[model samples]
Target: MPVRRRRSTALAAAVATATTLGATALAALGGATTASAAEAPLADYELTWGIKQSYRTYVGMFGSFTASEGAGQAPGSGAFTFTDGTGTYDTTAHTVDLAFRGRLVSASAAHHFEVTLTDLRFDSGAGEITADVTTVDTSGATPTKKGDDVPLAKVAVTRTMTDMATTLTTEAGEYLGSDGYAGAAGDPLTVVKKTPPTTEPTTGPTPGPTGEPTTGEPSKEPTTDPEPTDPQTTPATREPSPTASTSAAPSAPATTAPATTAPTKGEIADGTLGWGVKESFRAYVVGTVAKGRVTVSGGATQSAGNGAFTFKDATGTYDTDADKLTATFKGAVNFKGHESGGSYGLDLTLSNLKATLDGGTGTLSADVNSLGTQTKGVVLADLEAKSGDLKAAQDVVTVDDVAATLTAAGAKAFGDFYRAGTALDTVDLSVALSDDARLPDGGGSDTSGGTSGGSGTAGGSTGGGTGTAGGTGSTVGGTGTTTGGSLGGGSLASTGSDIPGPALGAAAGAAVVVGAGAVYAARRRRTQGRSAE
Candidate 1:
């Protein structure tokens, strides 16, 4: 690897329109589209980028960003994700050109700014990254707009294409004039291969749909259906079933299957779960970088003073004989900031947080919406509770401080902010297997116990002011309280140069991909920071 100063998220996806991207590709390859493209295996490469974290946070403070057409935000880091990466990396020539597909829009009506990242060209041989852009600004008199193909920032960096850190060119600075920023140091970009498991868009449907449609039988439907069609309504079509066959073939197993569930699993009537995700990241979103607010509802509570979030009304099953447990908690926590045009630059929702355990090995899952898309039952963290920690007593099972780490799947679901195996806040859970069973009365299982910042006398770096998430020792399964408080406030601990701070604001310069005619509006200008010039 070549030596580097620092690394930032790169443009894994381009928000450029189809026409513009095609032109860029053709121009880069000397107009031999059909000749060169087929040789590259465009589908193999993957790229992840956040443009500029500080700028993204600034935009999010007013409006929101959305990715569509097979593009998304990294679960671990909230960066833009683009796949089907196609390019030529020629070793002999010492040249590399990588182009990606997809589109992204960061709009903020409040700031009177909206820009779509259209096209980007990373020419390793030339050490240059250029962008084509389109912007909409109502902030000025009579709404000024730049063309979709406006040649935007062109920066220089190292020749390697791994995780890229970008900077701005003089041209970018001139465009910004006094309103925006033109400087060194942008966001980070990561380039890697798109694995087969993550290749849902390409290969997934082929085997699952084509092969299964021929073997065609079970995976698509419940074999328990009495017949292929409803016998009562269809009657004469195949007419023999419901009345005559009720006592025979399909009926017995259908009824029996329902009865078997009760024996194999123990029902949960009462329970609670306490978890806080990654403390630092949570702190970031609530902190200066994000300036977002966190809300808990659906019967959840926060312990006093930035305590662990407690999800209540647990309902699921525990298989004591097999040492397996599936507990689902009610309630939801939403983090939103960067309000613009009724959209948030940052929006994440975690609801119906679930936990599963067997032989002390377990996982936590949730219905997550981070990239303007909702994915249900996404396994987020792997639970590491020793079997001894999960002992059942008096018809109740309590697990405390069960360690949690991000999984690959969790990393993908959360935004690629952190890699797999990164530690999250410890988990504490309790489930009552019987009517007389009871959960702990308060936030006794909290691990962080951090009220202010958390180090000495509590840290200001989110190691404080949790002051609100799980309610202070509220009763589990009681009428849930909807508590609202921001995760980040006050000043940031680190404000060194080189890192983008909200102090010098900018908007929509993140990817700066080109989109000639596309436009959306950002919401309220949360604070006077930057505008996409």
Candidate 2:
């Protein structure tokens, strides 16, 4: 019984020790987890940039036509500066202010000018610098010649130097390195290193060569060495090499490698031309001409034409300071126009052609067709003189109005015929010439009357008159009749002479009466009524 008691006590003591060791192990594991949670994570970061530019001007004509060529050319240049133009991390919005100053390059007829951009900045993180410039005019001045505001010649240009791409690469930790800038006062940059995982020595049963469980007395429990009571000394730390460090150290945390934030030098090519508005007569024309082909955009229509009489590559700068676009087209233009019975050839040139842009409007002026030529059936002459102001007419009678007037005149003439009761078989119509319709020579004759042949008549009256015949006497009864005369006249006149004077007189008078009576009868029978003329 004594020996058995002693063995039991020993077993109890071993159980107590095993339980205490397990509790200690659990506490150490908890501590390791807490230390891991406090460790810091590595940080990696990049920087990027943007640029903008602009221009402005004023230009106009200055004198009288008769004196000093009548036109003045004014040219000027300007500069602008921008600064802090830098990139930021953590998605922050920022702005840079720009300043502009203008200089009058020339104020004479022969104009010369130059514009410069001073100390412009491009704020691209990673330290990149670039510029994007555009010209804007606040001045309302425009281009004119001889005090005349010529129409259809205005030009505004916005040019971008897309090829002006640049890049910048800053040392990775320059701004946030340990012992380096902390960015602001009182806040020192601190780098924390993560703790490595702690592993416990594993416990397991020993196996016999026969692969059988031959545990005689359980092997003695292994005792973990007590953690040193003296505070454990951390490993000595070595300074990190100026270059990247390869050796591991306790005091110095391994650096969180900086991510590369290098700015890329952008590849630059020609940029597309953007006209503020659809080109009108007074809008800028953007295009390229090569070989014999010209591709142009920006006018009312986009056109491509070949076989130009004169072909030359043209280049000119847009002076925003002068609000003028000066271009020289060295190519010759062969144009033909069809008129009534013939066609005319025109040789057009660009002599002193100046363009101005007013807002969205454009105006151009130049001496065209200075030298004329003729081709087969084509006459070359002063086009403006022959065509009489080919410019769109501001005042001209419309076809519709002229037709209305003729219709009204016909209606009036027809009404007059209807009131006159005239059979409209043949209406001779004629237009009376207005006083203004005189010939160029001044004097003019009236030919307004029109004659028409038709059947018609009119009537009128005259005083009425009649004649009567005296009573007739037969020759055989002459002698008997003489008795009546005898009663009337003293006695009848004898057939022969020797009668008394009174008797002779009575016979002669009777003869006269007979003759008169016969003539009256004849007149009465021949009479017919007269008609009015």
Candidate 3:
């Protein structure tokens, strides 16, 4: 009995000691969990910009666009000052600058030349804090043809924290005449917020057994089409037997599209076109040509009197060469002022519209005429399409560096709207067609709205050209969208799917309870033994 009693006491002492030690360990672990929660990884970002413009002076007679002696509206002629990193995020707040550095066009008629906008206090912001323009100094001019930067008076700057992306817009009257210039400077500036890239764990092939003997055939041997593991079947990869003709096949129609043909001349004159018209345009906008584009879809409906294809608010015609298509439209494009975005029309004729018979590859050029009634703000009065290389392939069209000119009448009507002689030189377009108008195994359709090989199904507009044309809205700057992307910094930490520390703590507590229960059971068994003795 004494021995049993001693054993019981020893067990009890052991339980108490373990309980104390476990409690201390658990307390330390809890503290550690709290500390880890307070510290997490952060991200950082910065801001930047780029510019796009035309360069030429409004000329007469044939409305020729000549090179300017001073600052040309040409691209790469502009400069950006104030400073970069204007929109940096910190723990407390962000700081930004509202300024630009470029050769600006003045409002004065005597000196219809270009001046620099150095230190022109516009509005700016950083992270959440914003600053307003307070100074203007456009007193100097650069005799050369590129943009020059001029300085302005200093103004008091203030800042505060706000949880919103910063946006910049320079109205016509922002600082054109405030300093010593005549009219507004360049196009309105629009900055877009960039998304940061997220990090993911890299995955690699599983390691093979270290010392296992080679058993199955080598992986290099080519095998016949293997059956899918899942019972479900896809028409694309399903191998059909000769006797499977009775089976309902989904891909049967896809194989039959190779027999299509081109359109007829009657259909072209009567405004009825083949499916390639819409598909080709779709292919261009989404593929290339446009930057910072929102969307591009099929335009208005077609009537019998119109031409072959109808884009938004416009109609088109195919030339007798069977290789060209001309589109025309007129309407209000913007709503800034009576002259800003009203009464405009143009005839966009595309050449080399035919694609190769087998591969669907070719080139498409433009003979765009900027002709129509216009308002005072219609800077793009007339555009005589320049002979340049344009391409069409796989139901898509593309053009690069195609030059044109603005009308002299349009320039004279610039009153308070734009720089009188600003150029409208380059015009570019990219169109990508959707599935309906996609060229079949053969080639594209004929000029008469008829298919060349077999007959193809008509395509519907998927709302390509999604951007609001001529409408006032923010534009994508020359800087890429990932500029202010997050890097490891002091910003709020973001762990997309990581396990939490608190959950681990709770799991540890559960483990302690389980251990305690086991100890109690052992103690009870020893007591029972003592009683039996």
Structural similarity to truth (TM-score) of each candidate: 0.39, 0.13, 0.28
Model 2 residue runs over 4 Å out of place are 1-84, 87-310, 313-330, 333-533
Taking the tens digit of each residue's C-alpha lDDT, what string does model 1 give over 412-483?
A: 654454567766778888888766655677463323222222111111112112222322211100011112
Q: Model 2 residue 316 lDDT? A: 39
Q: Quote the RMSD, in angstroms, for model 1.
A: 20.4
Residue 425 in model 2: lDDT: 13
- What TM-score number comes out for model 1? 0.39
Q: List candidate 1 segments past 4 Å from native.
A: 1-43, 139-143, 147-160, 170-181, 195-448, 451-533
Candidate achieving the largest lDDT: 1
Ranking by lDDT: 1, 3, 2
**Which model scores highest in TM-score?**
1
